[model samples]
Target chain A: EAGVAQSPRYKIIEKRQSVAFWCNPISGHATLYWYQQILGQGPKLLIQFQNNGVVDDSQLPKDRFSAERLKGVDSTLKIQPAKLEDSAVYLCASSPRRQSFFEQYFGPGTRLTVT
Target chain B: SQQGEEDPQALSIQEGENATMNCSYKTSINNLQWYRQNSGRGLVHLILIRSNEREKHSGRLRVTLDTSKKSSSLLITASRAADTASYFCATDAAYGGATNKLIFGTGTLLAVQP
Candidate 1:
C-alpha cells in the first residue's frame, strides 16, 4: 500500500500570482482533506471531500482558494492572487472514512513560498 | 485558531531519557491523535486514544487522555536520536453530523541528543 502522494514538494511564486497543488490519496480511501500549515503553527483545514462530494469547506477562503476532487481519487487545491500570508506548507491527507477511529494518512506537503 | 495548544513549545533531552508533551483543547472531542513529522516531511500517525479510553500504548509510546480536563499527553520513554521531530496532537471535534475533522495543535519540537 502506498501513502498519499503530492506533487511539487516545493514551490515559489510572486505575490498576486496563481498557483496550484495536486494530491493523490491512498487507494480505497474514501475521504480526502487539504490543510494549510503556517510556520510554527498547526495545520488549518481548507476543505474536505468524501467520494467526490465536498463534506466541509467552511474554512476555505472562497475569494482566493478553491479545491476539487473530481474522480474521488485525486484532488487539486488552487490559490489565485497569492499573498505573502499564503506562504505556507499545504498538506494533503486521506482517511478510510469519516469514522472517528480512522487514522488519516498524510502526504509530503507542498511548501509554497510566495514572494 | 488552533483547536488544541501544546505546552513547552520545545524540548531537548538525551537519548534513553523520557520525553513528555501535553495538549489541551477547548471543546469536546471524540478522539485525540498524536503525529510525528521529520524535518520537511509529512506527518506520521503515532497513536490515537478515544475519549472513552484513559490510556493506550504502542511500543515505546504511551498516550493518556483526560476528558474531564479536556487534555491529553504523550509520553515517549527511552527516546532515541531518531525520535527527534515535531510532535502534534489532533482532536476529533465532537459535533453532530460533522465529519471527523482532526484539528491539530501547535507542535512540540523535540530534539534528542545521541
Candidate 2:
C-alpha cells in the first residue's frame, strides 16, 4: 500500500513570509493529523481531521497556523507571517477511523526553515 | 502541553545490544503507541499496545503498557546502527471519539554504534 504523501521536502522562507505544506493521506484512511516537530523535540499535534471535518485543533496557533482537509483525503497547513520559531518539520499521518489501535502511517514531512 | 514523557532523553549503545525506553503519561489513555523518526524524516509506527493488553511484540520490538501506572516501555532487542533514531511514545486520550490525535512525548534519542 502507498504511504502518506507530502510535498516540498524542504522549504526556506524569510521571517514574516507565508508558507504552505501539503499532505495526502493513505488510501481509504478516514483520519488525518498534522503535527509540528521542532528540532530535538517530538511531534506535537497541531490539528486533526476526520473525513473533511475537524476533530481537534486545540494546539493550533490560530493566529498564524491554519489547516484544512477538504474532501477528507488531502490536507494543507499554512503558516502566515512565519516566525523563526516556526522552523521545524511538519508531519502528516493517517489512520482508520475509530481504530485507536491502528497504527498511523506518516509522510516524509516538510522541513521548514525560517530565516 | 505534552502528554507522555520519555526518560533517558538520550541513549547510546553498541550494536547488537538491547535498548529500552520508558514513557509516562499524565492522563488515562485508550492505547499507547511507539514510533521511530529518522533525522529530517517522518515517524514510522513501531508498535501499539491497547490499554487492556499488557504487551505486544513485532520482530525485535517489544512494547509493554501498564495502564495502572500510566506508563509504557519499548524494548528493542539486538539493536543495530540502522535503529539509530528518535523514539517517541504517544497516547490516545481516553476521552472523546477515536480520532487518533496522538499526544507524543519528548522522545528518546537512540544512537546505536555499529
Candidate 3:
C-alpha cells in the first residue's frame, strides 16, 4: 500500500515571500492533519480536516496561513508573506476515520527554509 | 508551548544495550502515543497506551503509562543502529471532546552506536 504523499520535499524562500505545500493522503483515510516541526522541537499541529471540512485550526496563524482539503483527498497549506520563524518541516498525516482511535501515517514532509 | 517534556534530551548507548526515555504531560488523556522520526523526516507511530492500561509491549519496545503521575516511558531492548532516531510522546488535545488533535512533547534524541 502506498503511504501518504507530499510534494516539494524542500523549499527555500526569502522572508515576506509566499510558500505552499501539498499533500495527498492514503486511500480511504478520512482524517488528515498538518503539523509544523521547528528545529529542536517536536511537531506542532496546525490544522486538522475530516473529509472536506475542517475539524480544528485553532493553532494556525490565521493572518498568513490557510489550508484546504479540496475533494477530501488532497490538501494544501499556504504561508503567505512568510516570516523567518516559519522555517520548518511541514508534515501531513492521515488515519482511518472508521475508528475513534487510529494511528497516523505520515508523509516524508516538506522542509521550508525562510531566509 | 509544548504540553509535555521528554527527559534526557539526548542519549548515546551501545547497540546491544537497552535504551529508555521518559515523557511527562500535564493533562488527563484518553491515550498516549509514541512516535519515531529520523533526521529531517516525518514521525512514525510506535505504540499507544490507554489511560487505564499500565504497560504495553510491541516487538522490542516496552511502554509504561502512569496516569496518576501523568508520565509515560518507552524502552527499546537490545537496541540496534536502526533504533537511532528522535522519539516523541503525544497525547490527544483533550479539548473536552474525542478528537485526534495531538500535542507532542519535546523529543528525545537517541544515538545507538553499532
Candidate 4:
C-alpha cells in the first residue's frame, strides 16, 4: 500500500515571502495532520483535519499559517510572509480514523529554508 | 509544547550491543508510541503501548511503560548499523470529548557502528 505523499520535498524562500506545501494522504484514511519540526527538536502538531473538517488547530499560528482540506483526501498548508523562525520541516501524516487509536503514516515532508 | 522528553540526547554503540532510551512525560496519556526517523526522512512508527499495558515486545524492540512513574523506555537488543536513527516517544492525550492528539519528545539520536 502506498504511504502518504507530499509535494516539493525541499523549499527555500526569503523572509517575508509566502510559501505553500501540499499533502495527499493514504487512501481511505479519514484523518490528516500537519506538523512542524525544527532542527534538533521533535515535531509539533500544527493542525488536524478529519474528513474536510478541522478537528484541532489550537497550536496553529493564526496570523501567518493556515491549512485546508477541501475534499478530505488532499490538504495544503500555507505560510504567508515567512520568517526566519519558519525554517523547518513540514510533515504531513494520516490515520485510518479520528474516533479511535490508529498508527499514523507520515509523508517525506517538505524542508523549508527561509533565509 | 512537547509532552515527553527523552534522556541522553545521543548514544553511540557498536553493533550487536544493546541500546536503551527513556522518555518521561508530564500529563496523563492514553497511549505512548515510539517512532524512528532516519536522516532527512519522515518518522516511522515503531511501537505503541497503551496505558493499561505494562510491556510489549516486537522483534528486537521491547517497550516498557510505567504509569505510576509517568515514564516509558525502549530497549533495542542486538542493535545494528541499520538501527542508527533518531527515536522519539509520542504521547496520545485525550482532549475535547474523546479526540486525541500526539505530542512528540525531543528524541534520542542513536548511532550504531558496524
lDDT of each: 0.93, 0.90, 0.92, 0.93
Query: For model 4 chain A, where is the 10-residue window of minimal lDDT?
Result: A96-105
lDDT for B15 in candidate 3 is 92
Distance from true location, Cα of B53 in model 1, Å: 0.1
Error of 3 at A35 (Å): 0.2
Evaluate residue B98 in candidate 4 and report its C-alpha lDDT on the 0 to 100 scale: 42
Q: How large an RMSD does model 3 have? A: 1.3
Off by over 4 Å in 1: none
Instruction: Please tell me what DockQ candidate 3 reaches.
Output: 0.62
The worst-scoring run of ten residues by lDDT in candidate 4 chain B lies at B93-102
lDDT of 3 by residue, B1-114 (tens): 798899989999999999999999999887889999996555899998878899999999999999989999999999999999999999874556768778899999999999
Tens-place lDDT digits, model 1, residues B59-110: 9999999999999999999999999999999999999744689999999999
Clashing pairs in 1: none
What TM-score, to 2 decimals, does candidate 3 have? Answer: 0.97
Candidate 1's DockQ is 0.76
Off by over 4 Å in 4: none
Q: Over the stretch A2-115, how does candidate 3's per-residue lDDT look in tens digits?
A: 999999999999999999899999999999999999999999999999999998898999999999999999999999989999999999999998234578899999999999
lDDT tens digits, residues A53-90, model 4?
99899999989999999788999999998999999999
Model 4 per-residue lDDT tens digits across residues B1-114? 989999989999999999999999998888899999997556999998988999999999999999999999999999999999999999897555445479999999999999
lDDT of 2 at A81: 89
Model 2, range B1-114, lDDT digits (tens) per residue?
889999989999999999999999999888899999886555888888888999899999998888889999999999999999999999999887655678899999999999
Distance from true position, residue A55, model 3, in Å?
0.6
